[model samples]
Target: MSLAVNPRFIPPAASTFVFDPDLVAEGRRESVPRYGDPIWSVLALTQNPSAPDDCIRWHWFSGTFRETFRFAAWTLVNHPLADQELARHGIAMRAKLSAGRIMRTVHQWSIFAAWLDERGITRLADLDTEGLADFAFYLAKTRGLSRNTASGHLTGLSRLHYYGRSFLPPSDRLVEPPWVAEGMDDYLPAASPLGGENSTEPITPATMGPLLVWALRFVEDYAEDILAAHDERRRLLNAADAADGPLLPDSGDALEAFLEGLEAEGLPVPVAARRGNPLAGAGIYLAAVTGTPRSKVRQVMRKPHWRTYTAQNHGPCHLGTPVNATLDAEPWHEPFTFDGIDKMVRHLATACFIVLSYLTGMRSGEILGLASGCCPDPEGPPAEAGRHLIYGRVFKIATDEYGNHDSAGVVREAPWVAVPQVVTSVRVLERLGGDGLLFAAEVHDKRQPERRSGRSLQLSTLNERIERFIEWVNTHAENRERESEMIPQDTHGRIGAGRFRRTLAWHIARRPGGLVALAVQYGHMRTLVSEGYGSRSRGGIHDLLDFETARSVAEHLSEVHEAIQDGEGISGPAARRLIHSAAQEHHRFGGIITSVRQARSLLADPNLNVFENKDTFLFCNYDRAKALCHPGRSGKYEAPSLDRCKLNCANIARTDTHARQLREAADSLVRQASSGLAPEPLADRMQERAQGLSELADQHDRKRVLAGMEGHL
Candidate 1:
């Protein structure tokens, strides 16, 4: 026998539920949500302070499901008993969950509720093992979601059960677990062995080179003219807005005076291109030249002489804002045409985005969240001569002032180190007005004043803008007959903001002393420290570096194997060891790395120290005891200093390619010595150096072994 409680005496869960103490203390009362509110505002709980209000709000349910599960959803997130039960099941309680995680939970629960409603089962107690199995099958088969995604939905349902059983009335409680006999794994698809590779593809060299070159050109060269035109257009628009009522009585006389001045100077009215033909708009051109309101210019254009002047002087006009940028000694762009200033400004902003994203390697959200003056010029510049830093918030691993998961992110202690190009890009963006954010949503569409929203630009919108930039680049290249300079389509389909960081990692890892590597090495030492600290974990850029390094190692080994097969001999002290190790690795790993762990493990092999030194025209088959690059250094060296490679180092290895490059260098030196331009002493030194290089090449040719002829060497 059970005691019956009166329904009238029971209090609503919303009235009794308590908010987190920290949140209540920190947040404004009006911003904080009551448990019973239809939309729970979690803006104060977000890690990104720049995140829009809509992004943090949790709208429980929409459409028909709202009426069916409104009370149930409220209880699941608010009731203390439900929260305690969820904590027991190893799920985070409402107060601990981040805004993003709570939103995902709500979305998943809504899907399940809608599915249950379709089957005419409304209450949690009505759900059973058979219905759960059918739902799993529907997620896996009908919906066709990936195994990981479907598993997430199932996990959400399991949490729902833990909370549902703690309901006030026993009739609404679920007595048994949702997955009675089987778990979520049993319903998921089989996992793949090679599944840990990052999905974001690196931008190929073909695309990245031209893309960056053009972006820099826009930022450094075309920026001045574009800004000038933008200002001129804005001034005209302001004048138009401020002029009240009708045209002034002197407006027609002013317009006629401007036309007379142009005629006297033998200058045609300013014409813009329209459908391959030059056409002049009297009102707009007169307004621009005479500094009058365009609204008044329209009234002046209605006069008879205005039509006669435009018809007689209708021709292409060369007048515009003067620009200093040039290509191949010719002006890169025609003088800025004020009529097309808006398009130019949009393209300028896109160019800045490309430069900042690719060069700095900041995550898209962090880059988009940048405010004005984030990277200010130094005041006196005495502390560090060349250190340029960008100060901004990092949301990925941020915490609040009280050491909790903060929705509003904290300022990063170590600012991002920027290159000169990145600094220039930021300065250019500053000139383009946004409320505070560098990439505000309304920055690109300033012509539409009514649409100003002061929100950070969305990633999806940036993706579209990137596509337009590419199209404009291709068209410009085609017009100039420089087809090779056009940015080609990447194999990874459309390039998005997320791929830049991975691409930067790939370039830095594979090309040790190339341009990108040098920039990263000097500008971002903090990244190196983070990489070292997180090397053991699957975080930071180190994992990407490992993957790319492993790939480079595998390709080198495969090339060595093929050279041995082709009867090409390797010459060095470690040649025999290199041959043996290369053959073993080729057979064992099959020239493929499946995951980051596998790449790290493969790179840990000490016997496989084949370092490609393209700058020195040889491979360093490095043995620390035998290396001469680190002169007078202590016990053991981790890697050969290829930049300081000695010509006579025992660790050096020479192949046919190395031999060819050596011969070419020797011949070039000989030519320089015989040219008679050098001093006598310098000429003698050049000849001696040439002789030594020729001997090394000859020695390699004589000592190289064929396949199965190691005994002779």
Candidate 2:
């Protein structure tokens, strides 16, 4: 007997019961939903969408998935699963898979559907355990699929059959899979794990260090030109008479006319790339400046308007309130100008994307998803060290109680501890626009300005913008050194969204922990413990990078340990302790560490592995509530003052690579002191720091140090 439910028992379309109380009536949306509740209705929820080809082209689904695959006479029309993908049928499933994954399942289901129809298998009774086994064998042997792939296809077909059984006519009801593949892994072996580096490898120091220096220095270096030019353009616009000619922002069409005028006068104007928006290249400037994403840049520049901060003495100030022409006193309608002034706004947003993504080990999506006023208590100082935070949205898969991606994905309200640069970027964004999206999309339908909705820069658009932004940087650099160092280009275009988090993690992992600034020691173990106590959410690239950073540290330690075993010498006051640590805890069973447990135990000794003091360049192996460099030596295994590292600490160990750096430092300091450019006191301090490093290097045998240093770093 067929074991399928009756078609009449199935529930009707979910849209009939969807209750969205917050949806606004057309044309009069003066206000939108709050951050966490941003659900507007879509036409597809009510009716069948356009052809798969056309549907995938829309901004929402424009990923790499090719939906229009040809399979003879059949069309792969797999309907959307309600509680998955979107806030779809409201049945949010727990395991939120990737788009590529979802597409693969649907494709497999469609292929199975085609096979069944071709074989004239019209009813559930037509298929049995024997036929299912035959198909599985056919998939494995005839089609040359691995056994695991064949098993997965069988599982997918079973799921499709179960879902369709209730909806199909009684004659077509498909029973559950007759055979189960679970626990048969020994018979049908799983795919082997990948060896070597993952394809999306972390950015190396040689590739990323120069870019970091450029991004950190560029915006401020060009600040005078960027802002002065912005002010001049604003003045020109504000001074123009309405009756005499067109003004900026009043008509979207006026932008073209203004640029044409510049060109006619033999002046420079923003140039567009071939088949690309010339105006979008400026986003790179903003990405570098703020390290946010293209979306944020677009929102702020769409309409550059903002409230002004006035002098305290200027009675009854309303800095952030919307402009009330008569009551807004003056400077109220000032162009949040730099945005269009030589494409400054977009540049600033791009700068924000680049810096935050690179420095904080954050995903580009998380940084770009940030909204206005995302920073917490900016006017007030942080209550404790490492408490400064930035509020932003995370774009990874998240679940509601039902396990589906929540409507807002994840509204990251708890402040992500931020550095000062991020804080500054937040403040800059706040001043760019009023209470709408901070980084608004470029003016899309210039004729219908009033009807346009505020939008973020789409992923496809952002990728293009990133490329253009890189080109823009190359064009503006003073020389080839600066230009080539920006984002080494190729046919694949500029560095991508994935590089930032991994690169940051790689650099942080490589920090020489023992001692650069000798006075400070950090409670790095405490920090690691604290991180462990917090959420171990690895959905975002940023979260994954955190684990990757820890892994990198462990890997680096193993490399050093192996080198020492091969007859490398250690240096400094702690050399004996370091060698002893390396000698005793040799890792058990090597050759591509398949077990994580073994890897952890391999680097567990405090004497062998060092923790980094993020605040200062100190790696303390201090323990016993007695940090040698921490004042009074009074912190436990997890509580050292990273800011108090002193080069004289007994707990510190020096590597050969670090000795070379010390030599360079000592020579540089001597040269500076000899020259008239360095003052006496500053020169003395530099000499003292350099001398400390020299003493540590001098302790180790020069021949041994020189031989092993290359391997240490």
TM-score of every candidate relative to the true structure: 0.76, 0.59
Which candidate should be chosen as best, given lDDT against the real structure? 1
Instruction: Report the Cα RMSD per candidate.
Output: 6.8, 13.0
Worst lDDT 10-window in candidate 2: 45-54
What are the lDDT figures for the candidates, one per model? 0.67, 0.45
Residue 110 in model 2: lDDT: 53
Model 1, span 302-387: residue lDDT tens: 56775576667755533356777787787777766656777788889888988887776677778887888999776666686655
Model 1 scores what on Cα lDDT?
A: 0.67
Q: Which candidate number has the best TM-score?
A: 1
lDDT of 2 at 417: 58
How well is each residue in 594-705 modelled by candidate 2, as lDDT tens digits?
A: 3334444444545544544433322455553445554554433333444567666766655565556667777887788778788899888888877875765565545343
